[model samples]
Target: MNRRAFALTFGLGLAALASPQAAWAEDHLAEAVRHTKAAVDHGKQGQAEVLVTHAESALTHAEAAQKGVYNIHVEQGVSHLKAAIAEGKKSNAQGATEHAAEALTHLEAAKKK
Candidate 1:
């Protein structure tokens, strides 16, 4: 009985270890979105670099979210953030402003859900 108990405990531990990756991914994605939102709230266009990175991270997490939990708006927001980051890199305030507007669209989409 003791041996059986040990085996059961070991199996449960292993199972938990296997499942957290998806959870971690989801956590990472949520963090990324938070970071992107912060960048958008600030006027630092150069911070787009960080925003893009976080957006990508969020995408990875969103992908890992439970299969049925598909957040299309979040995905779209990430895409918009990426484009905004790129545009900000290439142009000045006006361009960044335009891209920021686009990013806002995606953020709004995500928030609507």
Candidate 2:
């Protein structure tokens, strides 16, 4: 009976440890969405320098989130971020804005997953 009790306690302890990792994955995903949103906002404002900078930041965190969940949306978000950076480099505000908007959509989708 004591052995049974120990097994139950051990299982519960493992579950507790797993829960924090799940929560942290969500936190990292949320952070990616936040940064992507900021990049989109900067794109809309035609601030190519700031937009590129924020897109780089968002891509880094989005990549981290993808490591935790391996979601397709996160992968798509990274693609859009790369496009945004390229457009920003050319000083093409409209193209950067469109790409950033797409990245934002992908980020939101990843958040749901």
Candidate 3:
């Protein structure tokens, strides 16, 4: 095999290896966004307990998305989700709603990237 052919093969192999990880990250990020949106909706409805449930789910997926792919917006989104959960636990509907909204914004930004 020629050097050029070897280089091309190696590059393709690397790409193939990376594709799965990229797809996994995208899937997790999408889930996180979906859950965060739900949390925001529940928060708006003043359902603190329900908001907590969705926020926790969103947090799990957000953290998973961060495992191999680190984005600042996702990081911020995770933080907001945590805050939302905390406030929801305290039955602070307004606070939880605000935090969930913030999380949604950041998660959406991360998805765009």
TM-score of each: 0.47, 0.81, 0.89
Error of 2 at 68 (Å): 0.8
In model 1, the Cα lDDT at residue 11 comes to 100
Q: After superposition, how far is residue 85 of candidate 1 from its true place, in Å?
A: 1.5
The candidate with the higher TM-score, 2 or 3, is 3
lDDT of 3 by residue, 6-26 (tens): 999999999998888878988
Please provide, for model 2 over 12-108, each residue's C-alpha lDDT reduced to its tens digit, 9 standing for 90 to 100: 9999987887777678778878877888888888899898888888888888777767788889988998999899989887798799899889889
Off by over 4 Å in 3: 1-10
Evaluated at residue 66, the lDDT of candidate 1 is 27
Cα lDDT of candidate 2 equals 0.85
Give the CA lDDT, 0 to 100, for residue 103 in model 3.
93
Predicted structure 2, TM vs. truth: 0.81
Question: Per-residue CA lDDT of candidate 1, range 8-58, in tens?
Answer: 999999889767855664564555456555556543655555544554554
Q: Which residue pairs clash in candidate 2?
A: none
The TM-score between candidate 1 and the true structure equals 0.47
